[model samples]
Target: MRARIAGVAAYLPEHTLTSAGVEARVRAAGGGYRPHPTIVERMTGIASRHVMRDDQQASDLAAEAARRVLAERGTGPERLDLLIFGSASQDMVEPATAHIVAAKLGATCPVFDVKNACNSFLNGLQMADALIRTGQHERVLVCTGEAPSRAIRWKVRDRAQFVDAFAGYTLSDGGAAMLVEAAPDGGIFYRDFAAVSAAWQVGTLPGGGSMHPRDPEFTYFSGDGRRLKDAFVDNGPEIFCTALEKTGLTWDDFAIIGVHQVTMPYLEVLRSILDIPAERLVVTLPEHGNVASASLPLQLDTAIRSGRCGPGDRVALIGLAGGVSLGVIFAEL
Candidate 1:
């Protein structure tokens, strides 16, 4: 038995932030700020990014993507057995984001949010698969919405960290939804997934959660990237390798690799560490930056639609996020 995707959809922000635009804002703000797209361009490999307006929320963007997924699959919310939302950005602290997305979609299904930082979606996928495999549910809708642009702290003290955090430039406002069903036949399939967490040292916002005690200014739930490279280096390869092993496969066995890419170095490093082909890696960070959890799904949808991926294409979604959480997932596209 295999848990496979029935449909895939994405929602990208209407706003575009270019190199010139970012420079202009930094220069005008002038709190010892200057325009620098060098790392952003090199790391994310994206030339531009989509940003959500202050008025927009993660649920709004997620609903848009969910609509696309449902339409593409010819599915209605009424038929959905379970809806899982993977989000770090939520409108309220008490209500789960999944319920909000369901409400917006006119869905009356059992819904909840899965949050493991940027790893939320992959975790959600795993849980949905477990539920389906155990005959607990069918037609599980998996959603990932990230509006990290809202929480960006442009003023950082660390220069090297900021360069990689240049992911901020590539990080955009968007969401992705995919319909996962029990498939014993041909369909996009999930092979395996694994997660690990270190000390939660690298990525985090100062305020918002109970640990920091929320403040008005910290409402965005931002993050710090001072040691992003360290976070990736610490556990990315290990978790990714474990997933591949669980599936009885190797990095070289897959046709395409899609790591949770926020930077170009992430790909290069993972490729080198795992001894996978550079060409085997499918990257969208250069064009879209990091769409948070949506990054992989959005890029995967585009790659499939654009003929870059084909029937029987095996792709890997691997990366690390805040809380020092790291993981990898194997998908058969």
Candidate 2:
């Protein structure tokens, strides 16, 4: 048996932030470092991105997306056997955010959380697939509410600090949901992951965890952007090949490929390495920015809804997270 995606949906916050707006903010913040509006737009290929209200929590976003997916799948929350909340943002530090999301959606299913930075949603999909394939669960709902805008370090101390947090500028807010169930076929054809734990410190939120106490003004994003590119360029070929090998399909077999929404440059690198043509690739970064874990599914939903993909089509979703993890999931729709 295979775990097939019955439906997919996404929710984007109403407020939109443009690169020029970000430039204005940076200038007003009195940071010694300044980011040019055109530079951000040219480098990341992002003109605008959605932003959730400051009052809203990640669970709220997740619930909105999940409700849409449940309705589209022709089922209620009561039909879900398992609910997975996969996001970089959580409602709180104590109780799992999954419980809050479940309550919001009126779902009484077993709920849990998965946190793998930007790869959380893909991780949840793999778990859901395993459960369905093993007959442990029939229907599973995976959702992510990524609000990276909340943690962005706006007041940069210097040029170096600003450069380090440049990736954070691309962060956006969004949610996505997918429903998977046991079926005879038409599901995830192959899935796999690779990690370089030694490079885990490459991307980080320094002040939120145990090592560093929370500081509202100091909650800045940090990462070695060059190192991330180097890692991807180095490991992408082998990791992607392994997944294709498992499915006995290559880049030529996919109708559309969704790579992580980091930046246009990163996508270009992957496109070259994976041998995926520009026409066959889906580029959402220009419009959505990086919504973290929600990005992959959101892109997939956009592709399907826009008629870029249809039933019986093969698609691939690739993920890269802060732990420097890489994953590929190929599915048939």
Candidate 3:
């Protein structure tokens, strides 16, 4: 059985944060010499990023996206059989984000959350695939939202803090929704997916967890959790290579590669290391930055709506995130 996207929609907060604007704010706040925001953004080809209002969290952005997607698909919230929230910045820890989305969208169906750092959405896709395969649910609504920039520690604490702030500048808040149905439809169809984790490698949100032993007053966090970039880079080659091997195809089979984009540096590294062509990969992080789990879907929506998709077009969705996990999956558009 093929799990396909029935409809898709996205929501970017009203605010667009430009690199120049951020640089100005940092300079006015008495920060030392920092590279021009354009200089940094140029590296990723990103022009601007969106930040949600203080009152908004992942739930709000996700619900809005879900509503739009269902409406555009000519479906109602009541028809949704399954709802999944993929996120790292959920509104609460006790109750899953999917519940909140269901409440907001008036969905009384089975709702849950998928958490796996940046790979949450891919994980959700994998789960939805299973439900479709087993006939447990005919249709599932997958949603993702994140605001890594908002949680970034902007204050200069030490050398480690600099990397955290550096990473933060590349993060933006956004939401994406895709209504997936168990049908061999005209839309993109899910193929295969896999995930692996190495938790000791990289992490954020060390405050509340028992492993960190946090003391907000006495304890401090630098956010540059030790070679986080290296951890991701190290896993890049084997991940994509494995995906290709499983599909019994070569780089030539694909038209575009949509990887979990965090920076231009990472994209270049992946391209060179994975043997994927420069033109085959799509880069949106510079303008959208790292919109968390919504990264790939938002790009997919843009490509499809812009008339960039075609039959027999093979595409890869690669994801990397919090658990120090990496995922690469094949899909037909």
RMSD of each: 2.9, 1.3, 3.1
lDDT per residue, candidate 2, 192-285, as tens digits?
8989888888888777677777676546678888898887788767888778777788777888898887888888877887787898887888
The TM-score of predicted model 2 comes to 0.96
Off by over 4 Å in 1: 35-39, 42-44, 155-167, 185-196, 217-226
TM-score of every candidate: 0.88, 0.96, 0.87
* Model 1: per-residue Cα lDDT over 1-333, one tens digit each: 567777778889888887566656655654565656464465445677788878878998888999998998888999999999987677777789888899999999899898877778878887887788787887899997788777765654455534534545556778999899887755434444444445565455556568667675553333345366666676567666667666788767776776777667666776788787777766777666678888767867877787777667677776556776666666675
| Most lDDT-accurate candidate | 2
lDDT of 1: 0.72
Name the runs in model 3 displaced over 4 angstroms. 28-39, 42-45, 158-160, 184-201, 211-226, 310-312
* Better by lDDT, candidate 2 or 1: 2
Q: How accurate is candidate 2 locally (lDDT)?
A: 0.87
Candidate 2 differs from the real structure by a C-alpha RMSD in angstroms, to one decimal, of: 1.3
Task: Kindly indicate the candidate among 1 and 3 with the higher lDDT.
Answer: 3
Backbone-clash count (model 3): 2
